[model samples]
Target: MAYECLFTSPRCVFFTFTLLNQLLPSILGATYHSHDVTSDTVCNRYHKRELQVYMSDPVILETRPESAHMLTLGLSLSCTFEMEAKGFYTTGVVSVVQSMNFRSHGDNCLDYMQTIYEDEDNDMKLKRKKSKKKKILKKVVKAAVLSRRRRDTDDEDGRGPRICGRVLFGLQVDENETLPPPFADPLPPTKPDQGVLSSLFWDAPNPYQSLVSDAAEVDHKGEIKTRLHISNRMLRQNEDVNLKVVYTAYQECDGRRVPESLFHCGYGLCISRSLVNDGLVNCPFGDCADEVDCASAKEANIIAKVLHYERTDETSVWWIILWVLVGLVLMFLACCGGIFLFMRRRKH
Candidate 1:
């Protein structure tokens, strides 16, 4: 037996021919493939538009050089993301990782230890003097008590000649009081061993530090900013260091399921490509309006104004000083001339 089937849709048409049920599986497979292709095409267009929004404004990462003799401190790594004026970034995570070779041993410690020792010694001396005074006061109090008791017993109030309390109490009297133990000498600072310094300072050859921004969100026209601090203990001089930043953005589509591949603005907001540079904030949170976008142009304008004012101020200061000096010289010359004229007139 032979059978024929026809299927029609606005965008798709399918025709099938089968002998009994032998061709049924092939027909079903063809329909399934067509559906999948249509779905993929739609998803691709959506993904491309979403990526354009994210890539419109680039993220910036910057680092400052840190220097230290024995310890390097405050090596700062900054991550700046330019947000659209009206756009917002939904909940996202930003991670900053820094890796470098740090040395555990350095010769500068010798100089550093000298200054430390001087301060420690001065403090110890002051403490020792204070302790000595306290001990002397304790000794004086004990001596005075013993002398008063001896004199009081000598008066013997008719009680079969009162004996000295010291003898009655069977207490041995020492002519001199024993002093309290002296303070122990401060231990000298020891030099760290070069061979084992690395082991003692760090556990790994290349140490890496990471800063993560959890629950990070940017409002419409706001910035996503974070700073990573690399301490001197983690950095060494003349070592190559690398820094990396990773960010994941969240988007909201008003309850529509966003494809996993599409980039989104935070707080369930969808970002549009036309929003970039449109000067209108679209992100519900206003995370897009911060200075990250158009930072170069804004910074240039600021720098120009600052430089102009600085130069003008400098020039004005010099001019004022010059005029003051000239007036002083003129005044001195006039005074000298008047004195000379007065002397001549007096002689005449």
Candidate 2:
């Protein structure tokens, strides 16, 4: 079925990623519990018609040298619930990990062999060149790889993950099928490593390694959910890539057991505390309610006080120095006048 975009015009871009256990840990206070997928039914909408969510895996796109940076994967699915929203809402989050592996190019032996073939008359010289070239190539490779590893390690440690582009894809459930209020999904953390030298010369980190803490939860009753982990590694141009897609229907939670770290978004939705003041709009209504009146004001006040203290201290020191200099000059002038008078009296 043709899935139409809920936020904007429909586009035929598909992405596949694994849906994690509990999307919003802070919003849902209770420990994450997976639900039976057999009992729950998840459906997607196209042209106001309901259809089952289908999967098209391993979609390959060959990226050329000039246009690799501009490529983005977007998937829009309008999920329509089979049941009514009984004082609860459903949200789904998919985590994607993209890894690029660099293949070493230009074999030194092959280039040397080609050079030897060109100069067929120099048999003795070819043997000497071959022996010298092998030793030089090994040293060059070792030095380059070592330098690259050091640089890559420093870069990873010094800086946080770089976000290349914003990802905007979420479920747009109809009011009849879901809740009345429309909730906004906060931007999840993404890792976009676009290092040419590091990927080429050094081994990349394991993509499957979880950066988050190890916290697992069992399936709770009245909740239908599934957990999946996907690793997207070694992305290259003209390569047939297969993305593993795992499906997990969202769980319905009563608003009774709300966590202390959650911020209410007007009528129904609860946003995580970490998502607040993150400089992104997490609510559909009002001008970024979560970001408004954040700790930035307090920080700015503290900074202003520090600057004021520094300025006051500097001004006070300058005034004290000026006064001391003035007093010393006055004392020296008085001493000179007294000496002049004494000399005049003695001369008289």
Candidate 3:
């Protein structure tokens, strides 16, 4: 007998697995050496195929800027995707877009023109003869008029316009199979300063900061959706910016529940909240549990004492009854000894 399973989704890749089973009837009194012979054979035959077809049609669909017009420097964007399998995946995308460099231009262009004209007039009077004074004055007047007209045309409200420059936007996605990173995985280790362009602009507090790293999860239907919130300080007015999203997909077979604290042991293991500060080494490495969570030896000792007391409380009543029975038996023996003494005295 043969069986075929088909999985499909829109904007998602589909994977198909085929299994073949052949069972033979046993004769009377025949002995079977292995119970898993058929299953083992089937697995051996299809293992490579299963791995090859596991992920198919994985793609990033759209990368779009959230707004076309921004008064400040902040920017926002979103990336949507479809994947073949549900698992852990990671991707880094970067976009280079134009933004206004407000610091490059002065507020008043008229003041700047006046300073240039006065300096030029003083230099010309000192260098020129009387015969050439009229010609020099005519040339200066013509040049000043042209400069004023150009400045007026450029600055409509008497303030100079801002200059534009290219800005780099970056986003990183790290996702888990069962739960989102916030719930399933520990906070990633702090990154070192590698002197890359992205690292130079990665600011923690500023939303319009050039680089951002985030995590996301693929849904059951093999899709991932996420948004990036940008600061108004990162953008220019009515500017169109480019966006790009890159990604990679893989699978995780371990079936471990993520703890509330979301700490991981680095080797695909989750650290239990109960085990933290309990003195016992739950994580394979000290750093995996985080230095702050595992810092105090006194906390672990206190936790151990509390656990011991809890166990003692559970059996306290039984222990009390046993001790009372022993005490009563000793009392009965004493009474018997006293009665024997009195009987001996009376006999005498």
Error of 1 at 47 (Å): 38
lDDT of 2 by residue, 1-348 (tens): 122221112221111111211222223322211111111122223311111211111011112243222222322122212211111233322111111122222421100000000112277455646676355544555454344321122132222122111111111122232312222553222232424533432123311122211111111111112221111233345732221111112222224554565554333334444444433333322223444532231122211001011211222364367556755764565566667667777999
Report the lDDT of model 1 for residue 268.
Answer: 40
Off by over 4 Å in 2: 1-259, 293-348
TM-score list, all predictions: 0.20, 0.18, 0.18
Q: Residue 23 of model 1: what lDDT?
A: 41
What is the model-wide C-alpha lDDT for candidate 2?
0.26
**Residue 45 C-alpha lDDT in model 2:** 37
Which candidate tops TM-score? 1
Q: Tell me the tens digit of each residue's lDDT in model 1 across 26-144.
A: 23321100011112221132231011113222221212132132234433321111222212333232211111221223422111000000112376566646766455554554344
Runs with alpha carbons beyond 4 Å of true place in candidate 3? 1-57, 62-212, 215-223, 227-238, 253-348
Give the least accurate 10-residue stretch of model 1, judged by summed lDDT. 110-119
| Total clashing pairs for each candidate | 27, 1, 11
